[model samples]
Target: MEERTRAYLRGRFGDYYRRTELTPPPGANEREWGFIPWTSGPGTTMVRHRSLLDLGSIEDFLARKRPRHVYFSAGRYDEPSASSMSEKGWRSSDLVFDLDADHLPSVTLGEDSYAEMLAKCKDALLRLLDFLEDDFGFEDLTIVFSGGRGYHVHVRDAGIQGLEREARREVVDYVRGIGLDIDEIQTKEMRGNTPARVIEKDGGWGSRIHQRLTALSDDLKRMDNEEALGRLSEIEGVGDKTAKTILGAVSADQDVEGYTENEEVEINYEAISAGNIELGGVGMRKLIDAIAEETVSAENAPIDEPVTTDTNRLIRLPGSLHGGSGLAVRRIDRSDLADFDPLVDAVPETFVGHEISVEVTDGGTVELRGDSFTVEEGVHSVPEYLGVFLMARGRAEKGQE
Candidate 1:
């Protein structure tokens, strides 16, 4: 970045801090603070290992430094300003999950637009929330848009605050569905002295698979006889005879486990509820295994595992500007996350309602604030917000006044 551009961004950042009163993270004094100042270089330098006291008040420090980016340590410490990790008496750290769009498998880079990438990231966020909220039963959660390419979820539940790295890794594995074995989800029921293994129905992966199987049953029930038969035969191991047997099992004479006479019940609910899906049939077992894989893929949240395990990681501060994108690292309320648009909602009000001239160094289609337009390689006057975004992204330079 040019010196002129750096100076302009720095000055505007200072203005933003002067008017914006940022709420410090809990235990602010016990957490280390870091910031990246606008420097005349291609790479950034992180000024870290400073406590809240070293920076004075968050507001005053921001106004004075006008940093390019700001962050707070997820780990709280006794000697927060200590120069080394061993000296910083560690207490506890929030369980942090980072979902980056660039890392998402669904996203096809160079094809997906910024808006599309962000939308996919939001989908991933919802899946992550499902694991944290429904599976883990965590209540104290803070969600933030990273302002550059992803989202961050901070789990501040007191119960998990002091979890060591290995324990945190276990949490990560659960959410990511790593090393998940269907056999592990089974429970043994003692029938006399002999034990019988059954798939669980109450919670966790077993419950998820059961729900999927039930949904499949409902879908088959809705289909015509020929359609359902064709669908059943399409399963990898289900032959014509096997499919008919499965149909007969569904349309059994008895109503035990909700399978009434002449009713087409694809799954053996009696066996499933008893945690013995294998009793459903060989074809049914194959179908259940396929559904289990699908359930894991569909439900598991692909979060950055290292972030959750790292005790002393520096995370971008909420409500602070991301220097790379010139957008706010916004704290999004859970209720409003469904409609949050990072391109539009994360644009800083400090850069809105104004026009600025900039030299288009490496221009292309730019999308921001609910509009999309193409910019060629030349000097042009545009909205301050767009200009700042382009400048921060290194696609444009500040034009002469």
Candidate 2:
């Protein structure tokens, strides 16, 4: 790390340690805390079997050592220690969901920049939160900004604590919409001489399909025939023939006539006939299923699967500083998350208004307090928040402008 970066970390570690919550994992007398005292250190120094009775000791230790990184295990233990899990007899751990922009391929951070990447991850995090709370009916959950490029949702529901690794993997899969079968989700209805159509059902993936299809229908209406066909074909299972059929059906100037007793609907096939190409019940069903699958795939949260699956994972302590970004790992209220800007909200009070000079080592753009600026290769005077941020990222070094 740069000298100034190290100095900033050293100065702020005490306040961070004091403010950060040091809650041990459930049912544990001691929690294992790990620290990286220096950036060039061989590896993390494990400080285990620490009694949680005194927060003062941990604070004092942090003030003296001034670690570049701080972390604590999710797993609770009878006797928490790094040397042996057998000795500890692992009791239980909170189910952790790590939503990271680094894992998401949708956004290229090099071009989109960190702010955009963070926004993408935050949106995914909110969706995951909805899935956990409204879908899975989980209530005791904690949300934390990971201090770097993402967020962490910690499920503290007592029922979920003892879930095995495979069980946890299932939860991760559900959130990611992995291996969801569209065939099983869509409701098939036989309507007169026309082909069977798949209608969206009430819950689970069905509701998602319905929502996406509704939006897609509106969007398709605005596009020309070629554009509409191209858009439909972009869906995973939608082929050229299926896309053309969907485009024809959507473009046809005919309202869904009426529903039968079974809610099987009828469409005017005459209106949909663009040349000799006609859509049958089976073909229409296939197109709808394909669109549903595409919707589900797009809606899947870009979370790090391994983090959620690992029962014994160690996560960054909340209110601690992230070594890579010099931002505080902040505990966020679910209500305030919509307006929370991590760059502005997670900055430490110590560096809030202070000014510092730094030399840009890496060329890129950075956003601070809603202002965007290009990072040129040279020294420049910046606020303490941005200065420490760039230095921590190794993008800038301490120097006179």
Best by lDDT: 1
- What ranges in model 2 sit over 4 Å off? 2-8, 15-30, 39-57, 186-200, 216-236, 243-281, 373-375
lDDT of 1: 0.83
Q: List the residue pairs that clash in candidate 2.
A: 195-281, 196-281
Q: Give the TM-scores of the predictions, in the order they appear.
A: 0.87, 0.80
lDDT of 1 by residue, 339-392 (tens): 898999999898999899999998789889999979989999999999999988
In model 1, the worst 10-residue window by lDDT is 252-261
Model 1, position 344, has a per-residue lDDT of 92
List, residue by residue over 1-401, the lDDT tens digit for candidate 2.
Answer: 65565665577666666665454345434565566665544344555444344333556666666677777777786666646767767788889989888888678856877988999888888888878987789998889999998999889898988998999988988878888776566554444556543544566666777666666766755665566667767777777666555544543342222211233233233222211112444445565666656766677776898888887777887767887788888889989999999978998876777678888889678887777878788988888788878887878877853
Q: Cα lDDT of all candidates, in order? A: 0.83, 0.70
Instruction: Tell me the number of clashing residue pairs for each predicted model.
Output: 2, 2
